[model samples]
Target: MPLSDIVRALNAPATGKRPDFLYRSGLDHPFVAAEGRVFIHYANIRLESKFLPVVDTRSGRTHGHASTIQAFGLSNSVPMSPDAVFVLPTDAEEFVYLDRLVRTLHALNYLTQPVRGNLLLRVHSRHIISVPANHGLAFEEILRPCGLLPEQITLEINTDAVADKEHFIRAVASYRSRGYGIAISHFGRTELDFPFLSQLRPDIVKLDNLLLASGRPLDRIIDNIHELGGRILIEGIDSANLRRNASSLAIDLVQAHAPILRPSGIRIRRNADGGEQLDAAA
Candidate 1:
């Protein structure tokens, strides 16, 4: 759809009370989100790139719920728009729309700090603007206009969804050249590991604690990342024991209800045990 059309669709007047989390960005994309200086903090753990939000998915795993307006904006009825919007590199125009979206978010950063530690806030590579071989100067256009320094952002690649290797590698390098942090996440228990890490050299590799095992090659992987000057994140940690084992293997960071939420009585420390709440420092 044309950008003007999307904006017009969103700009149309509402019929009822709008949901607090609902945002009509005057774009075709309708998103449900919190307003005003909201940030999701990622614990630096062993490493320090602190600002990373998936789709701006946000800080420290502190998830919340927001309902869409019953009668306003995009839809005249229920279900609102879909909860998520996926962009494809089908055409240059897609990137054109995305470019505007990201730049607007970058401008919003001026009203709020986008950094937490040494890391940058995570964003996606849709519209080919984030993909190097396909970017076609999109990269050049984004950072400069967004007024974002390389240090405050991390571009994310869904590990399970990668379709092209050569082009993706080039994409990683392209962003890396400009100082963007790269993180590969949503890694699962399967053995379909990324063999190109040695070549791509992502800043962080995330794995699920559910996939932790007696003979998994996690140690070897950790060693490889350490050699490359990168770090590992263990997600899906639900227990103290799981966190304990992850810490034993030297997992750099984690995301789970227990770790993210400050346990009332636990002494938060970065030690042999699973450390304190990450947001504690922030």
Candidate 2:
């Protein structure tokens, strides 16, 4: 189906009120089509999706694309860091609504093309904590209308700040049970974290670029992750040397800063309106 038609279909009013847990009061379809791409409008905020390629070192091919959103203030057109949106003083329900909205926006924009590889999505830790049960159920429902399967998505969660390890483990298990892949973002550097990681058994372990720069030996950590059947992804890779190190270290996935700035095959129409400024480059 055409993207315009899909937008129309998605925006059409439902026969009954949507569940309050899914959206705030008076919120409807927030999606807009621009230059063949999708942007979302919500409460004086505008969001656009960017897909960063996660390259496979061995084949030198993109193994998957990680979905990231760039946010801007709708009133002043000033850019806001992606993390700023989550810091608002919103209730749990509203936060869940906002978090799921962003993920849905990414999913819709990505599914518009017949692309290879799974979609890597970063889930706010607060969003995980807000839900009392059934972690992936709501997001899975959101993906259903877009023809996206839970197996096609990997949820990246930053686990370092999680105060409740038990809750975190259960949440990861719930997501996995629903066919979603799990990735522990910015994973710890020490061997102590490895036992819990082994217990959790995530599909991917993402290391911060700073960890590699620290000159600490990651050999044991890498071996432990591999032994537990998890792949390693190094995030925020910025230089040629870092890329070379990633290959030499047997890293399975790498996310670079430069390639993320380039367009990943989606074209925005030149005629975007509604005070939403968008780049027309593809």
List TM-scores for all candidates, in order. Answer: 0.53, 0.86
Segments of candidate 1 deviating more than 4 angstroms: 1-83, 87-92, 99-111, 118-140, 192-194, 213-217, 236-239, 256-282
> Model 1, 75-133: lDDT tens per residue?
22111111122233246554445433433333233334433333333344453344346
Q: What C-alpha lDDT do the candidate models reach, one value each?
A: 0.43, 0.76
Global lDDT for candidate 1? 0.43
TM-score, structure 1 vs. true: 0.53
Model 2 lowest lDDT segment of ten? 268-277
lDDT of 2 by residue, 1-282 (tens): 676666655665463323233455577777788888888888788889888778888888888888888776787666666777777636878788888888888888997655658889988898888888899998887777677899999999888756888888899999999999999887864324876787788999998656776778888878888999999998655445656677677789987442222233233222111122335343
Scored against the true structure, residue 224 in model 1 reaches a CA lDDT of: 67
Give me candidate 2's TM-score against the actual structure: 0.86
